[model samples]
Target: MSGFERSETDEFARGARALVIYPELPGRASVGPEARLAESEGLALAIGLNVIRKKHYRVRSPRAVTLLGGGQVEEIAEMGRDLEADLLIVDASLTAIQQRNLEERTGLKTIDRTGLILEIFGERAATAEGRLQVELAHLDYQAGRLVRSWTHLERQRGGFGFLGGPGETQIEADRRMIRDRMARLRRELEEVKRTRSLHRARRKRAPWPVIALVGYTNAGKSTLFNRLTRATVLAEDMLFATLDPTMRQITLPGVEKAILSDTVGFVSDLPMQLIAAFRATLEEVISADIIVHVRDISHPESDAQREDVLHILRDLGVLDDEQAGNQPRMVEIWNKLDLLDDDRRTELSGMAARDDNILMISAETGEGIDAFKAHLTALIAKGNDLRTVKLRTDNGAALAWLHGRGVVSRQYVDGDIVSVDVSLSRQLWGQFEKQFENQIERANA
Candidate 1:
C-alpha cells in the first residue's frame, strides 16, 4: 500500500493513489521537467488526489497506441502495482486510444493533462456560469472518448414499424447525447456572455477606468487584490484558489475611483477547453484599460510563467497585433519581495527603478504598495487632458459630475461663478461636453 491511506468508514476521506508522469520530448525545452512535474503534482493535489510517486521520462519517440514505449509501459505497470496506485496521471496530452491502451495495460484509471485539468475545473467551478462552462468543456472532452463497447448495443430495440430499422450503437447514441447536451450548454453560455456584455456596456457608459489583475496561478494576485481593495476574496497558498472573476471599486493615490478586476490565473499549456469555456470571464481582462500582471518573484519558474501568461494573453486577443493600437497597457508587479533576502531584494528594487513599468512589492507586508498606487495614478493621468473651465454656481449637478468623473486639481468659487482645473479622459470630456454644453462660460488648457 502507498504511504498515505484512508479509513474505509471515513465518509469524507479521499483514497485514490496517483502516479504522475511528465514526459520530456526533444526540441521542446522551454520549461524544465522539474517545474512541469511540480505543476502536475499541484494539479493532482488541487483535487484531493494522493500522488504517491512521480517521474520524468525522456522520450525519443512517442508510441501511437500507448504514448510510451512497450518496455516503459511494463515498467510503469510494475511500479503502479508495487505502490498500489489506482490512478495514473500523464502530464501530457493523450489521444483517446492512447489513454485506453495505457489504462488497460496498467490496470489503473489513466488521465492525461487536459483530462486532469478538466476534472479539477469540474470540481472547483462554483458559480452558475462557471458550472455551465465546465459542463460544456467536459462534454466536449468526453465526446472524443466514446469508443468503448457496451453490452446493451448488442440488443435490438423495438420501435415504430416505419420509423426505425435498428437502434443506434452505444457509441453513436452516447455521441448524439453528448452533442445535444453540448448544444444546450452552448446556448446557456451564450446567454451568460450576452448578459456579461451588457454589464460591461453599462460600466463603459459610467466611464471609470477598469484595471485587471492577471498572472500565473499562485502568483499573489489575489493577495495583492485583497491588500489594495481590502476585500476578503479567497487568497490561499494553493493552485487556482480563485477561479471566478471578482471586481471592486478601488481609489488610486490621485485618481478618484476605478474598477479593479481580479481574474482567473494562467498556467503553462493551459487547456484549450478551459480557454474556450472561460472566454466570457476572460473578456473582462480584454476590455480593461490597464492590465496589472502580478508575478511571484520568489518562485523558481517565474520567467517561464511570465512567458506562459503572455502567450495566453496573445491567444485571447488581449495582446494581439491587430489590436496593438488600442490594447491595454501592462504593468509588471513583481510580488513576494519579502521572501527574498536583503541583497536580492535590493537588486530587484534597483532593477525596477530602471524600468518605470515594473514595480517590486511584497503584497503580504505592504512594501512598495504606496509607490504602486502612485505609479498607477500617474499612468492613468498620463492619458487625460488637463483643462480649465468656468461654471455657474447654480450648476451643482455638473460640478458634482466633474468631481466624480475627473480629477479636480483646483477649485474656487467667486460670486456666482466657479473656476476649476480638471483632468479628464477624452471619453469623459466628451460626455461632460454633451451634458453641460451651455453651462461652460470658457475653457482652456
Candidate 2:
C-alpha cells in the first residue's frame, strides 16, 4: 500500500486502542485538569483512536527520565497491559530518552502531545503549502527522537508521517540526512511565504477589506465563516477540523465586497515548531482589516480558551502595545447559543448586552447574524472620507476605478469633465493618490 493509505490502515486503524494520560502539575494552571484531559481525549478520538482508558495524575515533582514518578510509570504500564492498549499518548512534551524508556516499560508505542498534533495536521492539511509546513514540523520534531527506531518515517502518508504501527521493524538513519531534508523544506516554505506575501500585496491594492476569524479549535469558526459568506466549508464537531485557511468574498452593509478568512484553530500549549512552520499561514491574520474572535460559549472552560487564543494573538504581535491604535478592528463573538441552557444563555446575553464589542449568536441556527454583519459594516466605515473629484470625460478608467473602490453617491457630467462624489477608506485614498492623482482635475474633501 502507498504510504498515506498505509497510514490509514496502520496508524489510525478503526480499533487501535490507546491509553491517554495527562500529568497535572501543581500551581496555578488556568485550565483545570479535567478540562485538559477532556480536550486530550477529543484529540485522540479525532485521530480514530479508541481510547479505552483516560487518567490524570498529579505530579509534585517531575523526573528527568520519565515525566511521571517510578510508581506512576509502573501503574501506567500495568494499566496498559490490562487494557490491551496499543498506544500510550502522553498529554505533555517528552524527551527522546523519556519516550524510549516509557515504550520499553509499557511495551506500547508512545507519542507526546506534539507528535499527536503533528500527525493530525499531516492528515488534515489539504493545500500544498500546508503539507510543506507540516512536513517541516514533522522533521524538526523527529530529529531529536531519532535515537529511537525510525520506523515512524515509513508512516509518512498524508501527514508529517511519524506514528509507526505496532510490531513494525525499526529503521535508523543518519542525522545528516534529516538535516538536509529539513533545510530544503525551509527554503521551499520561504518561497511559499514570498508568494503569499505577493497575494496579500495585491489584495491591499484592491478595494475590499479583509476579515479574519480566529478562535480555539472546533470553536465554530468554519461554521460562522460559512454563515456569513454563504460558502460551504468543512465544519465538524472535532478538534482541528479545519487546517488549511479558507478565504472567500463577502458583501457587508455599505460595502461592495469584503474578504473573509477562516484560520486554523489555536489550542493551549500549541507546539512551537508548529508556530514557526505555520507563520506564513498566520500572517493572514496580521494583514486583516478586522479580526473576529469566535468563542464556544457552551464550553465549560470557555474563558480559559479565550485566554489561550489571546496569548497566541499576542505572540503573533496582533495584541502588542505598540500596535494598539493601529491594530485591526476587533470583535468578540459568543457562538453555540443553542448548546446552552436558558438560564446560562440569559446570563451570557446580559453580559454581551453590556459590552458593545461582544455579540452572542448561534451560527447553526442563524441567530444574530444580521447584527453581526451590521457591526462589521460600521467598523469598516468608521473612518471613511467623503470626497468630490473632477476627471476628464474620456477617463473612463478612473471613473470605473472610483466606482469599484468605494461607494459612489453621485455622478454628473459637465462638458468634458465628470464630477463624482464618493466615500473611500484611508487605505484606498492613499492608493488612488499613488495611481490616478495626476490625471484628476481636482479633488475636494
The TM-score leader among the candidates is 1
- Which residue pairs overlap in candidate 1's backbone? none
How does model 2 score by TM-score?
0.86
Candidate with best lDDT: 2
TM-scores for candidates 1 onward, in order: 0.89, 0.86
Cα lDDT, model 2, residue 104: 90
Q: List runs of model 2 lying over 4 Å from the truth.
A: 1-12, 153-173, 321-328, 387-403, 407-422, 430-444
Question: Any residue pairs clashing in model 2, and if so which?
Answer: 122-159, 156-161
TM-score of 1: 0.89
In order of listing, the candidates' clash counts read 0, 2
The 10-residue segment with the lowest total lDDT in model 2: 1-10
lDDT for each residue of candidate 2 in 195-281, tens digit (9 for 90 to 100): 989999999766578999999999999999998888889999999999999999987765668899999999998988998899899
lDDT, residue 52, model 1: 96
Q: Name the Cα RMSD for model 2.
A: 5.1
lDDT of 1 by residue, 1-445 (tens): 0110111111223557989999887776668899999999998898788999999998889889998889888989999999999889999888889988998999877888888777677667778888888777776776777667222212322220122226766566656655766787789889999999999999988878889999999999999999999999999888888888899999876467899999888888888888998999999999898999999999888888988898899889889766432344889999999899989888778988987789999999999999999888777777799998899989998888887778777899999989988889988888899989988988887
